[model samples]
Target: MSIIQQMNSKLANMIAAGEVVDRPASVVKELVENSIDAKATNIMIEVIDMGMGSIIVTDNGMGMDFLDAHLAFDRHATSKIMDESDLGHIMTLGFRGEALAAIASVSKVTLKTRQENTEGIEVIYHGGIFVKDGTSTLNQGTVVEISDLFYNTPARFKYIKSDLAERQAIIDIFDRLALAHPNIRLTLVMDNKTIKSTYGTNDFYSLIDQIYGSKMTNGMTIFEQTVQKIHITGYLLSPQIARSRKKDISVFVNGRYIKNYKLVQAVIDGYHSFMMVGKYPIALIHLEIDPSLLDVNVHPQKYEVKFVNESILAYYIETYVKEALLKQTHQIPETLKNISKGLDETYIPLNLNFGEAVISESKPVYETQNTEKTPKLPDLEFVGIFSGTYILFQNEEGLYLMDQHAAAERIRYEHYFNSLAHPNPAVKHLLFPHHLQLTSDDISVISNHPKKMNAVGFYFNEQNDLVGLPIWLNDSEVEIAIEAMVSMIVEKDAIDLAILRDKLAKDISCKGAIKANKALSLSEINSIVKNLRACENPYTCPHGRPTLIKLSHHDIERMFKRVV
Candidate 1:
């Protein structure tokens, strides 16, 4: 084999670009992060052709001088840190310093910057080649324009999404940045249209209201705690406003947004009993700790961080969240605003043991049933109770048993399930508006699926961070029901009306049904029997558990040695 040689600088940069710059979104993240690291208070981002033709980011921060600009394109050159010691306590956003060089290697890049006190200068590079040296320009802030991205690397260009998808990715990055720093003003313009413009007023709550709506803002509960070198602060949704998805959970370390599953799971565990099975609560958490305890350089992109005391941190977060939820009462108020959108579109039916029986709006239809039309059973005989839950009966050729509670649950489950499938006219009016707390991440998830919620039998007003619940839930057990439903919604991305209805029915039955030891009157027993006989699966409940069991006379005789 021939001896191998070192790869060219341009080729090496292209490889680095593969790690830091995957799509238009990756480019946006790196550039925006640089702006943040420079302590930019005001940032404006513009994208053309969905970031395919060009992407521009302008920041009013501490810009670089001519020499700094030249060194900025060299790998491993960063103003944020010096050596390994600085790795433990990183406060700046862009530390790797490879972003600019990697990005320039695959695209046409023009970087123009001027220190607050120095004259502006510009440098242009095309496909890793320096075409134009430092030239006098006319600006105080830094303006980076990247054009024809992936030009040198044709293979990378093919993976770019459609214009709309790419545009959305840009918006997502912009939103995350804006959420992380509510004190900074941010502007995002796509194809000459402004999608978001925020004033740097330093009001985190108001900013949340603006982005997620007042409904969510109002429902949030402020969460603050300090434990053993870790200080946590953020907002959490009330139990009544729980979600089924983790999209609403946001975690930030120092000021950097991070994706830590352990931290997020800790938050979930904190709200465990407060929510129903399979539901998640919305949270926006910011953690402040000594940088020496964490490592942010684990990945090339730096979206994730590893903490030295990860287990301890998780325990603290979980305990904090749980205590906070328990200490507060999240009951729905009686004076909520009515914001029902109607049930015409949202409804699905689950096929169970019950059948739909229409009820007349006028007089009772059962009262006018013809006396002669009803047929009687020929020679049916009543038998004693078998198991405590079932009633036994006997006939000439068959023996039958029925479960009272199971029959009731099946009837209720089927009724609600079918109603959800084709929702009838719903009487909806909010009794009291509820404020939902959510993290910035949760807000992103909810914002993406407004139509899905509306398609279900429930409608909410996305104003003021407070979601207006359906009026039908007014008299119901408010907190538990809402939490359960939200949990279900989070588990299932879309709203399936039938599943929701069935869940609601199960919850209600579990809470309101008669217990096993309760005594029943003869009339009540007769009524239960009639209902059981009418049901399709009279021996089992909605949960698929057998409601009744029968032992024939022959089996009883064999046990007693009468038929041996």
Candidate 2:
């Protein structure tokens, strides 16, 4: 007998099930994705015992005819694709044709479907065997019911997670699918009770509120950016609502949920100065790209995708995210908004002395609903410093308190960032060869990508010794800058000059900013205020700390007995 024997169709399907329907959530994902591809505007998913006991999916979508209804359980049977060219342009979610077969092989399945101009039909399958077929008096749609998951293959049940874990996993899939297609109404029912529901509507803001909470939309903002053919729409929540895990940082490409580290990191990078340490913002980034530019067949579950020119796409996403955050900076440090809202801004409190009026010559960028490009800062009269820290000022709209150190950091960060971006390299000879001792791993990393340092205007000899300095870097900060660069490269093997430049800028600016409890001359105050006002984003420093806050004139009156 030949050692290599072809497995039976049922055995083959059971093998394939290991990849497609490994968990309750995977089965739910496939069934729901099919409904989405079928042009379903309404989908309902009901699961019992965390989907191990039974799983039911009903959709008001284009139903399969008698032929497709039967073949749907056969391996490699699909309506999504036909030939090789179809692979390049895969707009549908379930193209592989493996899900139904794989799922049916492991469990009992009942499918009832009725296509247009066709009579209703029902079919049943047990462990990949066609048990029966019959007529049905059903509506014009499809309903698939799966029961006794992993019943035939009892060994697979050992890998099943706890009921709570499986339930949460299914819920995560529901959330992803709901977000991907907000126009579709999706409901999840577990153990005879409704868990989540999204009413079919185009109002994504409302949909998000339904999924997250009623007040979620309050902290979230929408932003749009387009470059060439690629368009991205980002819904970024304020950092205050950020979660500990990167799970909430979801990304969708061509309306399909995908896992792209570069794209997700781009959004995080855009939130660089706006996010506190050890926290990731809750963000939903959707990318609309030409199907030809995307390779969706890379993963079995179709979560990981490859995009041509992904770096360019990431760059645009990062830039626009930063732009949107800068435009909405006043909303951060949240206490400022909580105090001002529903309060009378028209009232000017009594018994308060605001010092001499200081008019800023340059405009400052403040939060506004206006479409104009230039951001405007409030007009304030300079008041004396408080507690040797806050730079106080008063305007008709409110009382302004500026964190002097934070303001300086923002100003200097922008300065260094701009210089790094446009390096006007005035190379000078070093008094001594600036030598950097590197570990073997560091040397290997440097040798692997020798251009990363040189691109930033740091030249090294064969021994990895720095020989020249860029004019933008001061002599005093040379050791600090070089040490930081080597550490970054050694730790993560960072190769991008842009990222390196940003890291250097953040570090250098923090080191150079003025310390607190120090008095300033009148001219120094004017200069600091002027430079800060001119910055692209002056509301927060590189570390996401607020540089200034505003308290309206009415806030003062409410504090005293002047007004209630």
Runs with alpha carbons beyond 4 Å of true place in candidate 2: 334-564
Which digits, one per residue and each the tens of the lDDT, describe model 1 over residues 95-187?
888999988998999999989778888999998788886666655778999999998888889887655456556766776677788888888
For model 2, state the Cα shift of residue 255 in Å: 1.6
- The estimated TM-scores of all candidates read 0.67, 0.61
Find the candidate with the highest lDDT and give its number: 2
Residue 333 miss distance in model 1 (angstroms): 5.7
Error of 1 at 169 (Å): 3.3
RMSD of each: 9.5, 21.1
Note the Cα lDDT for every prediction shown: 0.67, 0.75
